[model samples]
Target: MARITHGIACSHIPVLGYAFDHGKEGEAYFKPAFDGFGWTRQFMAEEKPDVVILVYNDHASAFDMKIIPTFAIGCGELYGPADEGFGPRPVPPVEGHADLAWHIAQSLILDEFDMTIINEMEVDHGLTVPLSMMYGHVDKWPTKVIPLAVNVVTYPPPSGNRCWALGEAIARAVESFPEDLKVQVWGTGGMSHQLQGPRAGLINKEWDNRFLDRLVGDTQELRHIPHIEYLRETGSEGIEMVMWLIMRGALGKSTKALHRHYHVPVSNTALGHMVLEPVDGTVPPSPTLEGNSAAAQARIA
Candidate 1:
């Protein structure tokens, strides 16, 4: 079966993409920010994953007010970078694993997690910026990607617990796949910052660091944090933190932290990054849970 070799979490700020594209890395203000990804890039080079299950939210670029899908999985053969206002970032298009994507979508729906299977979609900064942060400006992405877009922009987005559970469901789906692929699930967006109204430039470094601590040591407790608290304390957009739980959940209960980096004021967002691998260097075998495929098929029928 395909194994989950690593789990990564990071903030996906579009300005970071712009900075890298415009050769602003040496600038004093952006140096620390760029430095944060030094270790992550090295790690990725060493332990190359065959595929990346990228988790991010569309910033009203792809899915606007017309239709909002709580969970959308890209099953297309390829996805183009979206022109979010000022034309597309000069990044190569993302290649997708259609067979694996279709398998994951089928399993997720059967597991009762209603998902919108997307055959074609334009991926915006939320999806591509993380890729740039991870692999740098490459001729082509190092690996294929399965873009999993969550509806964080819409009010009353999926709760933290729900996102965590979905990650678990995705883990099950990935483990069931009969392949020798090395997969890594990435949860992108947020440490803490609100970019609207009078509360525009909010940043809670204390809360952000505390979150990173809990995420590394006590993830279950961190998963229980309410959305309202995140909104009230961390700032409205800070709720994006919940998405990280999905990556954590997919890594199983215990993981070894290979590298971690945290920096503040990256275009009004607290930039955070971490690389986690399964403790035993391989995912546990799929569990024979109560939900049998026959019963799942019956439910689907």
Candidate 2:
């Protein structure tokens, strides 16, 4: 069976594309923060996983406000770069693991996560920015991928607890797959920053640190935090931390942290990244009964 070897979580700030395109790689806005994440390239190199199941949310770039899928899986052969207001990034297309994505979609639906199956979908900076950070320009990505896209843009998105539970479901799917391959599951976005509307450029370093701490040792408390509280306490539009629980769930109860990095810039968002490897004999924590129950009812309601 394919083993999900590790999980990587990160933030996908659009400014990185701007920095790359403008040839200002040395500018104060991007230099130090970019340098701090040097560990990412190293971890991917050492692990050299066979497949990477990337967990990220789409910006309105690919799927518009008109139709949103709470969870979507890409089974396409390749994904193109997105055109933000400025223009598309000059990057090669992203390739996918079709066989693995197909199996995952079947398994997740059987387990009742009810995801949208997409055979052809283009990934925006949300997936590519992190890919660039993690793998750079190889002839091909070091590892193939199964793209999981969550919906965080529209109102009444999936709950934090729901995202967490999906992580557990993903672990089950990965373990049950009948291949003997090493895999990495990556969750991207948010530490405590906001974009869109008047609340743009807000950062809460204190909350970001607390989030990292709780995410490691006390995720239950973090799962119980409601979406409104995240918006009110963090920022109106900065609830992307909901995606992090997916990585946490995949890692199960305890993990050895290989590395962690955090930075906030004037470019309108806070950036963070984490690398977690599961410890052997780590059992999956019992699903948060109350939170999952409430999420189920919300779906039904």
Give the top-scoring candidate (lDDT).
1
Model 1 clash pairs?
A: none
Among these predictions, the greatest TM-score belongs to 1
For candidate 1, write residues 49-157 as lDDT tens digits.
9999999999887798999999999999999999888998999999999988988888777777889999989999999989999999899999999999998888979
Weakest 10 consecutive residues, lDDT, candidate 1? 280-289
How far is each candidate from the true structure, as Cα RMSD in Å?
A: 2.6, 5.0
Cα TM-score per model: 0.94, 0.89
Report clash pairs, candidate 2: 1-179, 2-179
For every model shown, the clashing-pair count is 0, 2
- Candidate 2 steric clashes: 2
